[model samples]
Target: MQHSLISLSILAALASSAVFAQEQKEDEANDKYTDRIRILGSSDKLRTLGGAASLIGELELESFEFDDINRVLSTVPGVNIREEDGYGLRPNIGLRGSTPERSKKITLMEDGVLIGPSPYSAPAAYYFPMISKMTAVEVFKGPAAIKYGPNTVSGAINLVTREIPEDFDMGIDLAYGSDNYTKAHAFHGETAGKWGYLVEGLLTQADGFKTIDNSDADTGFDKTDLMAKLKYDLSSTNTDQFIELKVSKTAETSNETYLGLSDDDFNQNPYRRYAASQVGLMDWDHDTIQLTHFIDFQSVDVTTRVYRHKFSRSWQKVKGFGNNAPSIQTVLLDPDASGNQDYYLRLSGQEDGKIVVGNNDRRYVSQGIQSDFGFKFNTAHIEHIIDAGIRVHQDEILRDHFEQDFNMLAGTMQNPQNKIFTTVDQEKSTTLALYIQDTIKLDNLTLTTGVRREYIKTHYQNRSDNANAKDDWLDKEFSIILPSVSAFYAMNNDWGLFAGVHQGFVPSSPKQNDVDVDAEKSVNYELGLRFAMQNTSGEFVTFFNDYSNLKESCSFSNASASQCPIDTDFNGGNVDVYGLEANLKHNFALTTDLELPIVFTYSYTHSAFKESFNSDFPQWGNITAGDEVPYMPNHQLSVLASIVHGQWQLNLLAKYTGEMQEAAGSGVELSDKVIEAHTTFDLSANYSLSAQHSLYAKIDNLTDEDHLVSRRPDGARPTKPRQGVIGYKFRF
Candidate 1:
């Protein structure tokens, strides 16, 4: 049933795109020529469409509004987006199937700054900057991302914000949706008297669809964000200088759990039922400030930030079975728990063309402790770009006070609280790297090549009161170097083809100690073609990613007892991934002056544990060759079509994912389960009531079809149900 649905959906989506493309061709017969498109990585935006080898490409923000970031990813070939929690905020992302850990494998950047809480933590959580603030997203898969530093072992996603316009412009939008969702956003900007300024703010709140603990529906939360930018024309020679500030706060409350469900359980209590679970609240806030200076061939940039986060939860659970077991198996209850604290820190830096150098020093008393320094150098010579950088980080942890309780007869129970505890621990690690790249321009092709050398070292010391814990687990560390190379050819003015092979590697995670796990590595090969016509444009890419020494979460000896550590070991395994993506856009010169755009994607992945393993218990401890990796499906596809006529536009998108197994399976249950593929349709339109005002209504999952977006091995938890939204926008 699952396979059939997936096949049908893929076929339907392809059919839709084909029809849409034909319609667009009919409309493009007499269309006007579009202006040259420009893609920006830095505010200086000094570079434009020149060579296909550049990290940046021409892109537009208007297309991003059609859907959330994940849905829009189909527009870009070779990129993939996955949603573990289904779009409340923190989304899991992956590209080229570079090890299916999703966000863990990809480095996410907002204006050149990493947004994840801990780059080394498992199940890396990421907030890719609200979609409303971005103008374009520069995606660098495989080796192209090596320049961004660590964690780009898989790829990198850079969220680029809107451009600073010279003319005055202001806009406001308000929206209301099903499930008690509301949002408001506004922005204003202008340039006058040799000075320019811009400010924007957004607020969003929602009362989710599924009810948990009998009330206060789970997934409800509020998120607010604001930003400001100021710029000055130091001299008439276009020597620009700018300052920008960004701030955001998110408060979420819900009765939730970390447990996921199996196929049968998902079909049963899909809403997720936990009698002992009660409403809980969590709060988060972040702030950033950046300063930039630019001239003809030289530019400088600086940035810093202060961040804080707090979380709490309430729940009840039975502790144990005693000799005085109640006649009716009486239940036990306890007070809800809280994991709350504020993370405070400030990071500063400076970078310019004259001499590329920067520093990142941080201070955070909570969420552990950390201090770090970063430096870089860049020198350009005839046909060569030489870049080198290094970072040093040290950390200290603070233990806090806590209470413990349990249940007794008749009802829940609680014991006395434990004593407060504190510990002094120091750890230091450093990453040193150097790279030399040369871009040679021939008749009509550009050949680019670069090789980077990286070295890493770490040492740790601990002074603690816990006698059972070791004073030092890791003694010292060593290093390894990775190399990459690629080339791009402009096969003429309208078409270009680029192909390259690159390597990636990640140092052992701090969470894992005692285990002799080597860094993970991968080699990627890609061939892409891009084309642009007078009235139409499109891009296609085919890629294959191969990985080795893949990391696997497993149990190891700890305190003479076999246990699963936060970080595990590198297992002997290999994975091969391939995919294709294409996007087409065209404008019609019909009487109605309509425009049509179509996009499609197809992906496949295969992986295996190269050998058998046994370290823990018997039955569930062995991993054999040909065992598939979890989460990543063998097949995936998506297609989207949109039409614009006057002030009104309509869009339809559909996606299909093949059946996939869950990670890790004991002997009793199947290693993986099939998720029946599902498809949904969204309808949206905008009507201009006047030159300055407009109204928009969007109905997502229009059919309200019931389906599972993800299947937890435990009991499945249904995501936000179907929804409808109505909104209005005003411009001045």
Candidate 2:
């Protein structure tokens, strides 16, 4: 049904393209142009601080038609992406040495608004923004990320959506690939005298590559997104102002599962799923509305934004094989253990079995108002640029979960029981934040100093018939102040030295007050050099993080082996992390009409515990002073090259990720459950047939090397194999 709907939409778009082209002929002849007014802090110029930051522009985004966030973010340094589903539907991104589980350690935003579900309470990024519809992506790393907010220990990622076009414009893109993959994206916009409006829609679907070992069910997903924006110019003689309103909605249905195969099963066929996961499914819906007002004056600029977001999801998946049964992880790790084989056999429907499935239904809402002021002044010989911001926000997550038992017979599940073991958990938080920063500029030197204060009040409640229910209701309040300073000295037009130091902070979980776990805090330092010439530019930074306290949260997906505790916090004591990140880009103009661009990026990270303590957390087992942080690779590298001539463009990318430990251990030996290093190559090409039409093709994982990517919540999972897609794009 989804495929048919998308096909119809594509056909309509294609038919409309012809009519639009004919109608736009007169407008094209007029050649009218209007300059777009950029919102405050929306341009790439905002990244000109003495720290590491990257801006992925529209050209780069259009090069590969990459819908997956992981693939697009691979070009950045000091970033790590752990693949869960091959399509990156849910990304686990880590910056520096932070944990990647649900990307909880970082600040995620879209159009400068918090995108995470209940960012102040439950920051799990179950509903990530659709990357295919984004116009650009901004990454702020190291001390430079202090401006973004509450979870600044790692970094921040901001997805910039398409702006209201200045002039009339329309575009459509359609693509199909292997495994029944299909995508359709279309947008139309126009700016009149005082108002601009845009409407866009995207649909993507795929029949996944993995197969259920003994079932005929399909592993696939279908998703759709729609957005509309309106902008009104309210400028007058005394004030230059504009008000913008945006509304968006997204829906998804995926046949996904958390149940993976054992080592033997993986060795036999890496793309096979267990029969128990045949009924696994995830359905979700998300909606957002935002209103922003911007005013620009001679010496000052002010912007205010108010936004509200709502998300709901229901995930029905197998929780365990049976009551009192070995966990899926145990069965995958040691299938031959005493009762593990029996449990596995039952789950596979080779024998009479009872499977426990959980209905994880949850709803989240986040709403906030934020205001920013920017001003500049000159005093004596120093010029000062001051920026200040304040935000008042509230977010909450409400979960109503229950379990059902199903009987499996003859490779089929039947006789589902009534819902049992109901649980109602609610987490809510209110946050107030204020920040101010000053940039002092002299002849060849620039210095930036900033401070931020965050006050949070969290409340958690659990209504369940379980033994721990009595201790489930709690309220906590906390406040913290973070400070940062950075300096840049320009030796010449082509060279500069930069250094920074900042405080890193991560908030505590709302439901973990009883654990007395403190908010994660660290002192971060970085030094780097920037060099640029006519056609070459490069940046290198060395960073260190000294943690006073490190925390591990036991969420639904990440828990100890013995117990799947939810909302529990574990203290990992102090930790030290250091890393080096470097990026280089060179453009070679081989001929007047031809040019080649080459880029290289590298990162090396070493993270270790500073104090030893025993813990029941699976990832933090028996913590030793020198135990390496789990899942953090020591080295990562990537190289990309592109050649363009006239209307033809070709690109190639090579990426390598070094070995990483799957568990906290003190050795680098292969026996330490190390995830081996892997490398992948991709190629893309595009040809412009006319001003209104273009053709493109992309091949990912060209080498088709099967490699283990992760061994976490379940068993080992492999990355996507070779795949190719061809598409057509039209613009009017």
Candidate 3:
């Protein structure tokens, strides 16, 4: 039959040309990924201008560590966190006035590394990261934090983590809040063939809001964590290799003592436990190891850390009623250990220039072995975009055992001249450095400049006693050269205009278990303005920081009639500070449709101490020059707001602190309330039915208000309370 009609018309024209070549290859792969990953996550003013505390995810992860991350960063307006006798153990973070204890001036990072405090210790410990796998947080204050380097004179916090995307996924979160709190978390990722994996775990427990009555002990908190990551892909130029491991532990039990409200037992029994049944005990542990290598696009890194701590205290159980009541119990401890070994080699790529080299080795038998070398430079010209770096460090500070225990809150039967010895004291040091930076763009104006130069060398050997304590090794060295500048202007397209000036240094911390000292300087100035439309935004600043010679650790005069053994005193002073900071943000798309956020911040801090320290100490006291610097705080305001429709979300936060001075030479008896800033609130909800499933809920300190976040009161300390929480989350 005519060859069956020509083979059925050639099989219907080859099935219509293979269905038009599969619809033209699916419209050219959907126009190259629908606009480059949706312009990298909905570019809202470039994600709030590269986030530096314009309030980012989870409100910039404030809690620093726990307290439910300050119940979600206290709703943002003017953050403030406190915990005197609560669960978060010893927690406090007051923005604006910049309080966060040894936080010095805020500068924390994770992912991008740098865990803070330990440039060679002397009162510097509090990096404490591991926020159960944080995903985002970035805040930059002061002179925009000068790109993260040494406290930045008051701001820089970045904590971003989350990289498991390669397919298969899993997630889990569980919680029970309000006092007995309780938390759990888990995550998993996969990619079998080329090998890729991720694992995470966390557990938390709390049983406190403060409600002890004389002593039953246990105002508790406990934590545990584990993390693992691995990846290896070598598909010809697909190169990649990464391995990560982490371990953590946390514990805090307290009865509270900063000594503020005790006038007849303050409120009769405000979480009271008349000191002594073992008040305040802490145990902390952390471990980390990392190795990464990515090719083509460059990346090489290695990191290591092992930290251990054991602290115990009990100082209040010696009362007499009618027969010399003696029930003795006063204790202290130092079962501690520390370690750090880091090495990095970087050469990032993305069509831009980047290079890095680093080394940091630190051991703690009393702080020794601190070797460093770092360099970096990133470039782009046409429209400018450059970042630079340089660093060199060296150390030999072997003189451990509570630093030859010179009475840091004496004990052991009440200071029998204070005993607790452990020494290595073979001090040797060298720290050479160089730095340079630039960020420029003309059309709409943008400029940033930097410079740094430093050199220091010192040596001291074996000294159980160096006459009055601060030996000046032969011709020890000290040199400094610092400079910085910043500017930005971009009216049109949402406005912008900013200004800056900067300088900072720190070179003293080795009161000669042998030698090393002469490095403490600061100079900073700023002016600013930056605003945007969509999603609302704002940033305004005015600041000044002046510190010279600084260095403090006094107590040498008349060394106990020349018994001279060594009583500590390494003085040098000068300090002047000034500031004004304003930040605002809003994201409202007519309520309930999703996304309604707002944030605000205000600050003013002033300090002085041109010099003068020995009139029974007190006009700010201690390492003198006017003393108000210890944790700076002289008026601050804050606020945060939120509202998210669909699945519910509501948040609000607040903070206010003014007046602070509690160290240097404490004459005691001062209390404009060293730290009295607080306010917090939170709420959350989530529900999704597909794409892996989801359900969530959260509430923290909704209103339980009544606060006093922190106060060392210089010496008699006591102040911390007010807490609440609730949570639940799951995804698969």
RMSD of each: 15.8, 9.4, 26.3
Q: Per-residue alpha-carbon lDDT of model 3 for 412-476, expressed as tens digits?
A: 11121223332335455555555555666666776667665656665555444646444534336
Candidate 1 to truth, TM: 0.73
Most TM-score-accurate candidate:
2
Off by over 4 Å in 2: 1-48, 465-471, 560-562, 666-671
After superposition, the stretches of candidate 3 with alpha carbons farther than 4 Å from their true spots are 1-101, 105-208, 211-443, 446-479, 489-491, 495-504, 510-531, 538-585, 589-732
Task: TM-score for candidate 2, please give it.
Answer: 0.92
lDDT of 3 at 21: 61
lDDT, model 2, position 690? 100
- In candidate 1, position 693 carries an lDDT of 95
Score candidate 3 by TM-score against the native.
0.29
lDDT of each: 0.48, 0.83, 0.44
| Residue 286 CA displacement from its true place in model 1, Å | 2.6
> What's the lDDT for candidate 1?
0.48
lDDT of 2 by residue, 401-514 (tens): 888998877777778897886668899999999989899998888899999999999999886778888686989899999999999888998788999999999898898873
By lDDT rank, best first, the candidates go: 2, 1, 3
